[model samples]
Target chain A: EPEVTQTPSHQVTQMGQEVILRCVPISNHLYFYWYRQILGQKVEFLVSFYNNEISEKSEIFDDQFSVERPDGSNFTLKIRSTKLEDSAMYFCASNAETQYFGPGTRLLVL
Target chain B: EDKVVQSPLSLVVHEGDTVTLNCSYEVTNFRSLLWYKQEKKAPTFLFMLTSSGIEKKSGRLSSILDKKELSSILNITATQTGDSAIYLCAVAGGGSQGNLIFGKGTKLSVKP
Candidate 1:
């Protein structure tokens, strides 16, 4: 079965530096989403995208965060300035009726 | 804010035991409830419940939703060590994006 895939399975970055997490959702899936989970915490929604535009976002998704579907397949989340609290597992998902998730990119901001 | 709550944060069960995981939610424009099994890196989709009373099943796992109560339950029958994982419940609502609000999750450890 086709599945969502993410790049840079693991990343380590200095605080205040920039990092971009990338994902390629399942083919034919229309809606895309980004969510993060701090260690031992619930998965929190960051933003949702459709038609190459943000549909909705959470308070956690602030100016530092941005998402883009730069191409037909690539969906990316960019953190302009990383913080210690930015360390988490970032997941990208897509859906037709039910959402499917990628393997996830584990971000570690030092 | 839209929120989800799961019960029995953690559970331990022997092989062949049956387990029920609970999830409740409060949100505007409730769309659907989904269950996922998280082993490590990412959550794998399990079931999506939209209508109440109807049950969705796959192998030994089954789930049902209660719209009136705004809750859902995931039941695993004839469990095995492979059934061990954190089960996450998420609600999609409030907007058309279907953005999810997740519960803390229920960790199940099925021992041999």
Candidate 2:
């Protein structure tokens, strides 16, 4: 079965540096989403993208965060300046009516 | 604030045992409730419920929605140790986004 794929299964970065998490959602899906799971916490939605633009976002998705589908098959999330709290497992998902998730990129900020 | 709550954070059962996991939610413009199973990786979809009273079944697992009580329950009968995992309940709000709000989940451990 086709599944969403994410790059850099585990990423370690310095505080205040920039990092980009990459995902390739299932082809033919129209909607994409980004979510994070803080250690020992529930997963929280960051943003949702549809039709080449952001359709919805949560409070946690602020100026420092941005998502873009630079081209077909690639969805990326960038953080301008990382913070310790930004450390979490970031999951990228796609929906063609039913949603499917990627294995996730575990981001660790030092 | 909209929230999803699951009960009995964790449980342990033996093979062939029957178990029920609970989920309750409060969200604006509720559309559908869904269940997923998570092991070590991302969650895998299980069932989606849109209306109350209709039961969705897949093999040994089944789920039902009770909109009147704003809750749902997942039942796993004749459970196997492989059934051990975290069960997540999420709600899809009515709109184009279909952005889901998920509960923390119930962790189940099935022993031999």
For candidate 1, the per-residue lDDT at B29 reads: 92
Query: Which parts of model 1 are misplaced by more than 4 Å?
Result: none
Best by TM-score: 1
Model 2 chain B weakest lDDT span, ten residues long: B91-100
lDDT to native, each model: 0.95, 0.93
TM-scores for candidates 1 onward, in order: 0.98, 0.97
Q: DockQ: which candidate is best?
A: 1
**DockQ for candidate 2:** 0.77
lDDT by residue (tens digit), candidate 2, B1-112: 8889998799999999999999999998998898999898798899999999999999999999999999999999999989999999999884459888999999999999
**How much of the true contact map at the interface does candidate 2 reproduce, as a fraction?**
0.78
Candidate 2 CAPRI grade = medium
Model 1: per-residue lDDT, tens digit, B23-111? Answer: 99999999999999999888999999999999999999999999999999999999999999999999999978889889999999999
